[model samples]
Target: MYYVNQNQINKRLEFLNWLVETIPESLENKPESDKAILFLAQERILHLALESVTDIGSYIIDGFLMRDASSYEDIIEILHGEKVFPSHLLETLLGLVKMRKKLVQEYFHLDRNEIYPLLHELPTTLSEFSNSISNYLKHELNT
Candidate 1:
């Protein structure tokens, strides 16, 4: 059971929103030389976890890669393991897609259909989810 504090939730949301604006910029400005290093680090971590872990590997992979998932159902099953991922991780993933949906579409010149699967109206969804999770945490943690 996770005990998510209100203060933590607020802080995490703030951090997530800030990162929402920064990540695309980071990827855009990432230097040619550092791109390889960045990918190497990512691959290194993926291989390490795949080699060593049982229950949590897919969670890490899905969160980081965001694709290459075998199936949506498999991802959901992994996410429902004894250790639920921190709620903000889910929120951030959804929130990032939500926040950048338009920008990505414009930048890539993609049509609505192309970006549809990549984004959701998570600003609305996240608010509801945040409240619900907060309520659950309050009840479960008695905090």
Candidate 2:
């Protein structure tokens, strides 16, 4: 049997919940005068949400003695392999992981046109991710 840190996972989930709720408002209320600030805010929100997903995945992988993840992509692959989330989301999650990398590494050069569509889609993706994690935890840990 493996140990899972339910409390830690729960805390991350709670934060994700907040991010999910905030995404719609943030995207909807982007002011013409504050476009730069709104862009940064959107980027930060995406970064935080992606980070939380990886953090939670790391926690579960570590707790369950899953093979070591060599990269963020590996973390998502492992979770998918374990059936923690649906197969349909595998590609989307991988894309998000890549976006996370770009957000961190190439923040100065990101094209707003490219990112705007993603910002619009993020809330649904995050909601699905959060639900998957919750369900996986409940089923695996009997919580």
lDDT to native, each model: 0.38, 0.84
Best by lDDT: 2
Off by over 4 Å in 1: 1-9, 15-112, 116-120
**lDDT of model 2 at position 50:** 79
Candidate 1 per-residue C-alpha lDDT over 37-65 given as tens digits, one digit per residue, 9 for 90 to 100: 54434333222222222122243443334
Clash count list over all predictions? 0, 0
Q: In angstroms, how far off is 39's CA in candidate 2?
A: 0.4
Superposed by TM-score, candidate 2 places the C-alpha of residue 21 at a distance from the truth, in angstroms, of: 0.7
Runs of candidate 2 exceeding 4 Å displacement:
none
Per-residue lDDT over 5-24 for candidate 2, one digit per residue giving the tens place of the 0 to 100 score: 88898899899888988887
